[model samples]
Structure formats: structure tokens, C-alpha cells
Target: MTRTTAADVRRDITARYRARTAKSRARHAEALRYLPGGETRGATRISPYPTYMTAGEGAWLRDVDGNRYLDLLNNYTSLVHGHAPPGIVEQAADQLLRGTALGTVAPPQVSLARQIVERVPGIDMLRFTNSGTEATMMMMRAARAYSGRDIIVKIDGGYHGSHDFVEISVGAEAEAGLEPKARLESRGVPSSVLQSALVAPFNDLERMAALLEAHHERVAGIIVEPMPNTGGMIPPAPGYLAGLRELTDRYGVLLLFDEIVTLRLAPGGFQQIAGVLPDLTALGKIIGGGFPVGAFGGRREIMAQFDPAQHDQALFHSGTFNGNSITMVAGEEALRRLDAAAIARINGLGERLAAGINALFAALGIRAQCLGYGSLQQIQWTDAPVVNLGDARRAAQDTGDLHALLQAELLNRGVYSSNRGMFSVTTPLQESELDLALAALKGALQTLLPYMREVAPRLLR
Candidate 1:
């Protein structure tokens, strides 16, 4: 085997993707009239144009052009059971017949809430919202209100939601020279909002501690994703989460675990595995059963702020579809089906996929690596360990062209990964699917090797 340089990988991948895009571009041109950018989500858009999928079943998506591909992306990891799982579909269909949304409390909501409270060790109570973005927004608001403080801390490169407060420092470029302290990422976010956030590097406990000490009084809470999914998946170093817990306690800052993406790690989530309980937790994706849902819950006292009965203390939380019957029924069914054994089985499959891909990279002599925690995995083009958002930015800057190449190649080979290499294994995916993926990866690498040898020779060396 010969090692492939990054430059060669980029050239080959671009060429392959360019050829594939010719087909996708035509569909996108047709779609632009109906949907902006030919897609609903910006994250789904890629160079050339997004491939339009007509339908999905199990772990496969059929594109509008009639191309079938293994759906490793899994609707951004929302379909834990894969597309249109019988259990979820049947339950949702039954609930839809009953009604979609009712203004009053629903039995399904209570049932799902009970299930969450039981599985998640730290959540003593819970409240529902329409999306993970809403859940995180409420969590931050509650933390600020509870502590009577202005500033909140978040891990650099961590993504909580699209809300203004937590969006700071997300996907920042390394060239921007972001400081150890937080830096805002968008305009019109309000200087006050930017000032209110403190950013620290993931896995850098010392820097986190320093920030905590410096802003002890003003810091109201610290929100972190147990394993950050954006900027590639970066798992916390051992004791890193525990250390954050201890520091938050010392500084009297609320600890919020944004498990929106990491919840699939286990039935109880990363908080259980790390043994570091937060004051609040945010959840979405799998819990919703393919429907849009989000939840924030923790200590009973802290959650009491949202009680509508309390006139003066109410948190003003209200949503037309919050705790709606349809979401609740579907969520409950999904939760019922997702027991410890099921989680273990899916995570095991994820481990297998990760290991297989890593082994393939080694065999192909590629300067690439797979990184993730539990079921969520990302393939980084560089060999460097991604510890924080800055590290991810640097990696992206170093290999953006290569990363883009690999993404196109993988898609052409019938494996649908996210633009950033994020892939999740659904319960439906088996060893056969993983094997196919590995083979596809090998073929992709082979196709790029010659280009690498001529271009970025250092990667091979």
C-alpha cells in the first residue's frame, strides 16, 4: 500500500464530484423555483447542488433521479430506527387519526416524560418544545433567570442551537484568531448577547477553570454538548466532563448538558456514561421519533419556573404544539421501543462501522481518521486529534479541499454522509451495510491515490 497525499486526494475527489454534480445540478435547477437553494436546510446544501431525495426506507434513500444510496446521514441522526420504522409509523398514524395537536395536556406526553425521567438519571422533571433549538433556548433562559446572572459559558465549537446566545464561537475560522474567551460568530446578534457568553476550549480544563474564575460572579451557567457533533465529532477527554461539573459547582454556575445529538449514545445519554450530572439537559432527535420535538429538564425546583399556575414566577413558556398529542404518541412509542438492549445493539453497530472505516483508512495508507463517540462518527481528513472548535477549524482549513473531495466520492459510491463527514448508524443498518461502506471507501481512496502522489506528497510521507 502507498500513502496518499492530501493534495492528490483533493484533486481526485473534486473531479469525481464534478462528474456526479452534472446530474444533481439539473434537479437543483428545477427545484430552485419551489425551495430556496433547492433545499429547506442550509446544512444540506453542498457545492454544485443538493441531491433531491424522493423517499427513504430503512437505511436507504431514493433520490429524485432514482439513485438509491445507503443513508448514513439518517436525517442528521434523527432517525434512530431509520426512515419510516414500522413502530413509529404505526404509532404516528394511529395518533394522527386521533388528532395532531390539542391545546390541552395529552396522556402520551406524560408517558414519554415519565420514560425520559426514568432513563435519564439527572432529569427529575421535564418540559417539551417544538425543536432542539427551542429546548436549548429555554434552558439558557431558565439558567440565566435562576442564577440572576447575565453571562453564560459555552464550550468553543459547541453547537447548542440556532439561537443567538449559544451561536457564539461556532464554526469560527482559525485564521480569525479567536481568543480563549468567547467570540461572536454573527452580526445583529447584539453586543450584549456576545458579551454574555464565555467560551472555553473543549478538553482544556485549565483554560475553562481560568475563565470560570475570571467571570465567577457574572457566569450564570455553562452549556456544553457532552460530545460536540459540529466541527466534527469531538469526544470529551476522560475526566473532562467531570472537571467541568466540579468547576461549575465551585463557581455556582448552572451546568447544562446539551445532549441533543449525544443522547443516542445510550438510553441514559453521556451524562450517565460520564457520571457527571448537569443542572439541566436538552434533548431532541431520537426522542421525537422522526417528528420535530425538543425537551429541557432537570431539578424540580429549577423547572418550576415554567409552571403556568404560578402567576408571578411563570417562565412564560408556551407553544401551540408543545406536548401535542401526535409528537407525544410517536415519542412515547419510540422511547418504548428504545430500551437498553436496543441502544446497546445500535452502539455496537456504530463501533463496528467506526473500526471498519479506520482500518480501511490505515490499509489505504490515507492521512485520514474517523472520530466520534458512540453512534455518531465523523471522518476527519487530517490525522490531528480535534479537541476544540479551533482545532476543527484548523483541520478544515488544512484539508477543506480534501474533505470536499472525499464527501463527493463517498456520495457517488452510494454512501450518503453529511457535508462534514457526519454519519450515524440506524438500528436497521447491519454488518452488510457496513461492509458495503468499507468497500466503497476503499474504492474512493484508490481513485484518489494517484492525485495525492503528485500533489500533497507530505501526507503520504
Candidate 2:
């Protein structure tokens, strides 16, 4: 018998996916006439054409092909309550009729802001934006203005947003080692932007301190995801966050926590759970109640920079849809419903999902491990301790296309999630849905075993 290779598995998966998603393929072709790569967001793109989703209800998504799948990705973890929650829908509809966007701040906007400040620790005040990208950008700018520094320290492989300063070292090279010199991950980013960003290793306190110490004079802020979401959902190692807080304080540099995805992890986010607060916190995703929104806020002194009273020196900030009524009311409703109990329940489910997948991997004698903090998960094909982005980068390099193949297999089995092996549990997710996802995962693993044994036998050992 011929040894089955990963390429063979990929080819088979692609062929099957193409056959099943003919309509989506056609739609993608039609989309190519106007949109770049037939999609607006790069995350949704996948091999053999991305499935065009038609509708989503609760934790399920219906594709254009009329196939329904349990939505494990949950729109990149923006929908904590899943899709079309009754209260949010009603609130959004009401706000739409009243006005989606008003020139002045609306009642709903104030209400939502208050809710955020009350729940999320360290946010004395905040300003809304259209997306997380804008939130992070504004936070960094605020830090620069507050500290009068130009350089910003960021974790390697940490994704803040699409902004020029943050668009560096995101897909950092594993072989480059710790605190690799900032390299732009995308084209069109000027060299000045790259130079202004100092890349540091995640969870490694000593390395982080060294980077800050070396460049503390020029450093305005150290921006990080409290629990890294895009860089494989890696949690902070014990005192990692506390250490960051200490270093920032000692250096007089602001600390900005990007809680866009991890906000769903706790009632007050991972910062509350960890008990380490930053000077500024960037929030998005679930806060919008399944709509577009982002915010950054912190100490009153820092946030006051945006206060119009200080006209001459105030950081100039304005957006046409900054505090849009629809998202505001919907977000307030979403936050209102996401109580402590709901957070605990969803986080518990995420833990169970990670544990179940790890058990399956162990049973199959694989070197794979499911890593993440509460309510988020990522399947890393390495047993190594994944404390930082470099470790994650190594795992990604080692796994080759295993994750992609697994993702394709999962989709084929009627489950949808990130092809990069990330998944998040929604508030409305049932235990039965998790069970089904686990079953699909197990089947996916079994199907990939031959390829694993041939291409990278260490994974099966």
C-alpha cells in the first residue's frame, strides 16, 4: 500500500469541499468581479473556496448550499450569545427606527459606555469606534500623547489590528528567536511604522523587561492581549500580566490590554480574573452585541486627552458612526444579558471542550494539545509548553498543514471554525453541540492519522 501523504489528504478534502460547495464557488466567482479575493475579511477565506453563509441563528449557521453547521467560530468570537438573540434583535430594530447614527452622542451610547466602564476594570472612561482595529489604534495614540514617547512595545505574533504600527511581527518567524526585530507582516507599511514598534516575546518576563529597559526612553506603551486570542489562544503564564503591569509602572510607560476577544472570558474580562489592570484597555467583538464596535479607555488622566475642553492639546478624534444608536442599544442588551453566571457557564463549556479534545489526542497517542484560557481554544499540534508567541510559531511550523487539513475535515463533517485551529464557545452553545463538535474532531483526527504517520510521525507518537 502506498504511504498516504498530507498532500493526498489535502487534495481529497479540497475535492470533496469543491463538490459540496458548488454554489459558494459560483458566488465567490461572482464576488471576484467586485471584491478582492472574493471576500472582504481574510479570516473567512479558506482552501477550495469559502462557504458563503446565508443565515445564522443561535449557535448554528446556514450556508448558501442550505447546509447548517454548529458555528464554533461564532463570527470570530464576536457573538457571545450567538446570532440573533431575541433581546438584541429587538433592541437593534428599535434603535434602527429611532436612528442608527446621530451627529451627537445618543442615550443608548451613554448607557453602553457606562455598562463597559462598570464591568471592565481600569476603564474610567471610553470612546467608541467602528471596529477593534480603530480601538487599538486610538489606544496607542493616546498612550503616545500621554507618555510623550514614540515607540510601542508589542508581543510577537500578537495581533492588535490592521493599523500600521500593529501590522508588524504578527506572523513572526519562529526561527528568528525571542524578541525578533520588528518585521512588517503586510505590504504598504512604511519603515518608520515598523521601526516604532518593538517586538517582545509573550509570557517571558525577563525578555520583556530587557526590551522595555533597552527602549524605555522611547516606549510609550506596551500593548498586549491579556490572553492572546489570534496567536493561538495562549494564556498568560501565572505572573506574566502582573510583571507587565510592574514593568510599565517602573518605566512610566502606559500598558494597553487588548481584550477584544478575551472579554468573554470573565464578567470583567481576564484582567479582572488575573487582578492586573492596565492603563488602557482595548475592547471590541462581543461588546457590540454582534454588530461593529470598538472602544479604548483607561485612567481618567489618560482618557482626558480626548476631552474637548482641552481643545488645543486634546487628541483629535472623530468618527461618523462612533456611537451609533443601533450598536449601542444592542451592545447594552448583550452586556446586560452576559452576567457572571453566563460567563462562568460559557467558560466552563470551553474548558470541557479543550479537555475532551486533549483526551482524544492522548487516546490516539498524538503529541497534540489544546491550549487556551477560559471560553477560547486552539488545537496546537505540539506538546511543548506554549507560553509565548515564539512557541506557538514553532508549533505552527512543525504542524505544517495539519491544522488546515483538520479544519477542512471538521467543515466537511458539518462543523465550522477557524482553519488555524481556533474555536470559541458561545453563551447559547449547548453541551450537545459540544459533543457533536468533539465527535467531528475525533473523526477528523482519525482521517488524518495516515497522513500524520507518513508526513510527521512524531505527531502520532
Candidate 3:
């Protein structure tokens, strides 16, 4: 009997992936000439090249190689209604016929803005942008303008976006201290950008309060994700969001919630559920109806920074495609369709998926946990409580290889998900689809256990 090492399992998986995705490989090779690493987005890049998708619909994607997959990635949780819902497509097409970019305030844009202002608890007024990165960037700028402060506090491992300021300390190596240093995520991000931002741990209210207290005077705002999707789908501890609200109020520093991912958690977003409101909220993803969009808004006084009436003191905010007709109509349709019932259905599936995976890991004697809220979930490979980014980082480091192997195996089995172990349940996902995904995950774990035993004996319970 041959004892298969971790490397052997990975080799087999890579071979299978390559054989099934030859067209994807060729396309990637051609793409590499124009795009760096053969992709525009960094997260979609997989080792041995990535699968090239030709089309997607109703929670399924068809690859260029003609292989079909259950799309759990859902465009990084942007596709709440799954790929190109009939309504969204029709709405977008209608808008395209009317005008894609009218270069004026379209009626659909105003209508959608009104809906958002009425729904989201934190937004009184909002300005749209091209992406979530722009939303967060503008939020920070508005915060600085309102507070007349230069420094901003951000959560370690919380992925706001790729913009210069928020690009600090996201999934950086954990330091051996209470106060974490702000490490630059990208090379071109200036050191001065890092200097302007203070990094704090997610879910650590006491430590965050202390750090904020020390830097209260210079701090403009504290930006955070209500439920951090990137840092292993770590949810805030009970009363954590409330504590942050209190701290921000006490210190006179603005609170900014990056609800780009967590907005799908509730009609009014995580803030509505948690009963904690931010001074400014950054939104994107699902709100765009699967199109590219972003928005930031807050209290009337704070959001006045973008008011054209006060030109002298106003923080200049404008984009070529901001509130374009296509995105605005599409977003309106998406939000109109995403009711409480739909949210509940998808979230329920997510809970079931998480529970099923956790039960499987426990039964198989694997030291791992599935953690998330609402429709989002991730498999953290360590038993340690994910109280902060440091804990999550340590846990990931301990089982990085095994986690990668699990992702590859799941992909080979027709389930597509993020390599970082994150997956979302789309509105179109059915109970049967969820069952199949869980079954695939269970099979992946069972098949990979021998390799786990070879590489990580201590992981066995």
C-alpha cells in the first residue's frame, strides 16, 4: 500500500484541473501578454492557471472548456440574485435602450437613491461610484473633511478595497504584540499612506477602544466591516458593534461601516440587525445588481461635504460613470427583488452548509471550524477562537496547504469557490444545490484526510 503524501494529492488535483481546463490555460497564456498574471483581479488567480468562464446563470457557470460548476463564489458575493437574473438583464437592457450614460441625473438613479436612503439605516444621502474601492475611499475622504482630522483607523485583515489608504494591514503577517503595525498591502502604496492609518484587530473591542482613545484627536474615523468576509468570515462578538458606536461617539471620531459585503445580511444591512449605526456607510456588490458600482453616504451634515452648493468647503466628488443609467436601473431592480423572504431563504441555506461542514470535520477528527453569518461562510483550519486578525492569521498559517488542497478538490468536484475558503449562498441557490455542495465538501474532506494525516497528524482530533 502506498502512503500518499500531501504533495501527491495536490499533484493529482493539479493534473486533473489542467486537463479539464486546456482552453482556459491557452486563454490565460494569451491574457498574460496584456494583463498581469493573466487576470485583472488578484483573488481569482489560482495556481496552475484559473478556469475561464464563458457564461453563468442561476448559480451555475459554464467554463470555456465546457465544464459546468455550481458557482459558490458568486463573483465574490456580488451576485445576490446569481448570474444575470432575468429581471436584472431586462432592466439593464431597458436602460441601455433609453441611455446607458445620459450625462445627467437620470430618474432611475434618483429613484434608486431614494430607495437606498429609505432602506439603509446609516445612509441619509449617498453618492455613487464605480466600485466599492471608490465608495470606501470617498467615505474616508468625507470623514476627514467633516472631522478636520488626518489619521484614520482600520481593522487588520478587514478588506475594504484596493485603494491606497485602506490597503494597509489587510491580511498582513501577525506581529507579536498588542498594537499591530500597519503594513502596506501593495508595493506601490506609499509609506505615507500607511503612516496616515492606524491598524487595529477585528472583534477586539477593549483593545480598539484603548487604541482609539490614545489617537482620538488626530483620528478622522474608524472604518470596519460589520462581518469581516476576508478574515475567514469572522463575525463580531456580541455587543462589539455597539461598543464601537459608543467609543466613536465618546471620542468624537466618526464611525464608518464598510457594508459592501454585509449589506445582504439584512434589508437595512448588518447595522439594522446589530442596532449599531455608522456615521458613513460604504456599499457596493449586490446593490449594483451584479454590475460594477459603489456608494457612500451618511448623516445629512457629514454627507454635505459632497454638496455642490458649498463649493469652497466641499470635498470634490465626481466620476465619469457615477450613477450611470445602466447601473442605477439594474441596482434598483436587484434591490426591489431582494426582499426579506429571499434573504432568509439564502441565509438559512448558509447556516445549514456551515453546520453540515462543521459536523463533517468533527466526525472526521479534523481540527477545523466553519464560521460566518447570513449567506457568507468560510472554513478556518484552526480551533482557536477567531477573535482578531492575528488569531485568524495564525490559524491559516498552520493549515495553509491543506486548505488550498481542499479548495482544489472542491473545484474538481464541480463546486467553484474562493481559494481563500470563502463561499456565499446566492438567492438563486436551492436546498438541493446546497445539499449537493455539502456532499461534495464532505467527499473532498474524506478524500483529503489521508494527505492531512501525512502532513498534519496533530490536526486529527
lDDT of each: 0.82, 0.88, 0.88
**Pairs of residues at least 3 apart in sequence or in different chains that clash in candidate 3:** none
Per-candidate TM-scores read 0.93, 0.97, 0.97
**Tens-digit lDDT track of model 3 for 1-461:** 97887778888888888888899989999999999889888888777788899999999999999989998999999999999899899999987888788898889889989999999989999999999999999999999988889999999888889999988888744754557878898899889897689988888787788888799999999999998888668888999999999999999999999999999988999999999989999999988898899999999999987777965677888899999999999999999999889888889999998999899988998998889997999988776677777777777775637766777788889999988788899988989998899898988898888777877766777
lDDT of 1 by residue, 36-66 (tens): 7788777787665676777999988887667
> What are the RMSD figures for all models against the true structure?
2.8, 1.4, 1.3
Better of 1 and 3 by lDDT: 3
User: Candidate 2 lDDT, tens digit per residue, 1-461?
Assistant: 87777778878888888878889999999999999988988888887678899999999999999888899999899999998998899989988888788889789889999999999988999999999999999999999998888899988889988989899999855874544778988889888897688888788789888887888999999999988878578888889999999999998889899999888888789899899999999999999998899999999999999987964588988888998888899999999999999998998999999999999999988898999976899988789788777777777775667877877888889999997899899988999999999999999898899888877788878
The backbone clash count of each candidate, in order, is 2, 0, 0
Worst window of 10 by summed lDDT in candidate 1: 397-406
- The alpha-carbon root-mean-square deviation between model 3 and the true structure, to one decimal in Å, is 1.3
